[model samples]
Target chain A: MNRHTDTPAGTELLDLPMPEPRTCPFGPAPVYDRLRAEAPVTRVACPTGLTAWLVSRYADVRDVLGDAERFSSRPGQVVHLMAHADPERPIGEGEFTRMDGPEYQRFRRHMGPEISSPRRLAKLRPLVRAVVDERIGALAAAGPPADLYQDFAIPVTTASIGGLVGVPYADRDLFHTAASGVFSDVTDQVQLAAAVRPLQGYLFELVRRRRVEPEDDALSRMVARAPSAEPPFSDVELVAMSAVMLVAGFDSTATALAHGVLALLNDPGQWARLRDDPSLVPGTVEEMVRLFGGGAGIVREATVDTEIGGRPVAKGDYVILAIQSANHDPEAFPDPGRLDVARDTEGHLGFGHGTHQCFGQQTARLELTVALEALVRRVPSLRLAAPLADVPFKTGTSVVGPERVPVTWDEILPAEGEGP
Target chain B: MRVRADTALCVSTGSCALTAPEVFDLGEDDGVVVVLVESPPDEQRETVGRAVRACPAGVLSLAP
Candidate 1:
């Protein structure tokens, strides 16, 4: 399982850290800027103590993430921190993210429609809105000086995803705890395995139940669609797919929502603009997605010798797409540092690019839009309770977000219809 | 303007629908890009162009 042992002889590995920690919440590591200008694709040391090429420019990052044939998503191909300590597993087995070629397509085809179909997402909008309203209501009733991350963001995201996945309301805490551990930055192989086992077992049992008596939810739909596949999906495959979706959907969206709120509060002008025009919520959410740091951990491996940003990449070479750097690239985004709610953030790599792009992006957008809109409209005077520098930020993880966003607001505005 | 989508290459990221909903919609059954307006009006040409550029899969294109 030691991927570094497979490193070709005579290749010089740079001692740069993977996902260089941010000194500022809004900006990427300063080294990323230098890399984009100097070496868009250059070797860097991974947290696993291995080396991989980091692609920094927007176009080059897209090139690497977009070409599936030339670049493979197979698990063993990438340099994960825990890979050496864990046993070698099959490439296309656990999750579609780890699979390439037909195997990846098969699973994605079955799961994609359930999550991305416009008709289905349209139906889920109200459910998502309701989740937002309920969470905001709880926040409003509980009074000021609350942890928005815990009080609102986590609940709204977890409930929305949980409902879609058919996890019962009462089981959300259990689901959240187990799913969070799986996505956390725990480097110990045994600890990582311990975190993943509970989730795998939970999903297996859930899928088993759905198979017997299907419910009106995403997992049930997946269970019903399983038999229609060419060879039919096995229980193990179903569980793996479900686990991946849960971890991917919950962790990323929750992180984005929390960070989005923090960004708005930090820039009062943007918050005021959003509150003044609720119609701008969707656009603001898009801008927030562009500005945030969600895709810092995306990795791909070259299956064939290729050139990116004019740098040669050998087969089996691991490449990390510096998504935040790409998103902030001045050529792609004007005034890349400023939070402009009106900017046309058309091609930002927040959800990433190419075949492996996020399937749940539309749903994630809907959740962020609804949640942010509801929060602003309900509490017009909401502001951060603590200094921005004092806020705890989660680091050393694929996803970056505030661990706690303590905020307070002037009087809780009376519920609509209970007007003055 | 004539618009077409390479369904084979589409990954259903929905960037087209997000950018130009009038011209493209995600297929209900397969989750691939569905071209709603093959020949879009002149007014929609700009939006279609944006959608084409926004597509992560590079599946959509306009007639030259």
Candidate 2:
């Protein structure tokens, strides 16, 4: 099926076969590396059974992500079932993920103030530090053989998002269960709708309470900020957004952090350089963003027949921007696979490139930087508690992480001033 | 030369502050942006440059 008709602009629309997904010893999937090295941009069959272009070139991905109008995010980004899913009842537009133009901007603006500043994020530093410290404490208490992913990273990230989204500390378990259930494909429409009902119901109550008694929290602020309209969330939006915040804030950062630490650990020299200079943490974080390769791709469905990467994509086709592959594109970064903590990763599309670039990035950065720095400093002698091969690497469908990163240290007792 | 933020346009994402904390600070409540000094330490020029590049909303500039 390599034959293709010429576009009106006279560009050739060559049919490119989708490369098989990449898996290698060095971590990143092979499809990405192969695309970056060989094809960059090619056509692929999406999970939704639609054939569309997958842009892997760094410049191309950034260009698409930046031009939000051309590559609309509203086009059923999530799996159709997931997007149409109703936790209570299969419903209409759920939240910002699938929204565009006015409505997207409206809700985005309402929530912007909370996540826009270092100051806003700084407020959560103490809480994040506490979570980090607690995780470290648990890891230490459990002894050398501990899965860092479970014992440390996941919990810290979940707790941090829980705190930020105004999930009462006591009800975090409920939030976690519901969040996980919502993402997992346990059922068609019924299970998700049922799971979401309780979670959204709680958020509704929380929003109502916040409206009457505004707290110094994001939920309260967003409640006050969202324009008074016909459906001022109707308790539904509040709950939905709250759950969205938890999933968005928690999983993305958590996965990034886990993979980042794993990358550093695998590379001794990079780890040493970062540990030696705490000042390098910022650069290190960007490199991690480049390497973590968070979302595989941002999926967008076509509104009208259009040409992408010189290929004719008919209306209703889904376009997937291979973000992870693009980040590794050699044209974008010199020696892309080399874990240079000092690499200028300014344009890396890890947290995404443009307007829809993660709203919680600042928060993610704070969590990762602080957590990584503390781990490096405190666990100076930290090493993998189990063989890399034996470790259950987090993989397959959706988010990727180490199911458990078991680590060990030969009891390098804490510094005199450092408290346990 | 150093980068500074025009607080009026600043969205307060702290991309600059995170990139070069030595050269940028944010107000506690209102989220107003602040440059560290009329001129930052020379050693921080590259960091400041990165800060200028990191500002997503394009509110930061370099002063020669």
List the DockQ of the predictions in order.
0.57, 0.25
Question: What are the lDDT scores of the predictions, listed in order?
Answer: 0.75, 0.67
- Candidate 1 structure quality by residue, lDDT tens digits, B1-64: 7887878777767778767888888765456688988999998778789989987777888995
Q: What is the DockQ of candidate 1?
A: 0.57
Q: Model 2, A1-420: lDDT tens per residue?
A: 122221334333434333222334333566567665655556555433344566777777777766655666765444522433322222355567666555555445445557766567778898888878777877777777666677777789888887787776677666666666655533455665666677777888888899899988888877775555334544566666667787667766777777677777777788888878878887798888887664546776566777766656666555678776777778888787778888888778887755576767888888998888788788877777666666565443356566666677776445325664
Residue A216 accuracy (lDDT) in model 1 = 85
Give model 2's docking category: acceptable
TM-score of 2: 0.82
Q: Tell me which residue pairs clash in candidate 1.
A: none
Q: Is the docking of candidate 1 incorrect, acceptable, medium or high quality?
A: medium
Consecutive 10-residue window with the lowest summed lDDT within model 2 chain A: A1-10
| Candidate 1 stretches greater than 4 Å from native | A1-13, A17-22, A76-88, A92-94, A414-420
Candidate 1 per-residue lDDT, tens place, A284-358, comes to 888888887544546777788888887777776777778888898988997787888888877788887777778
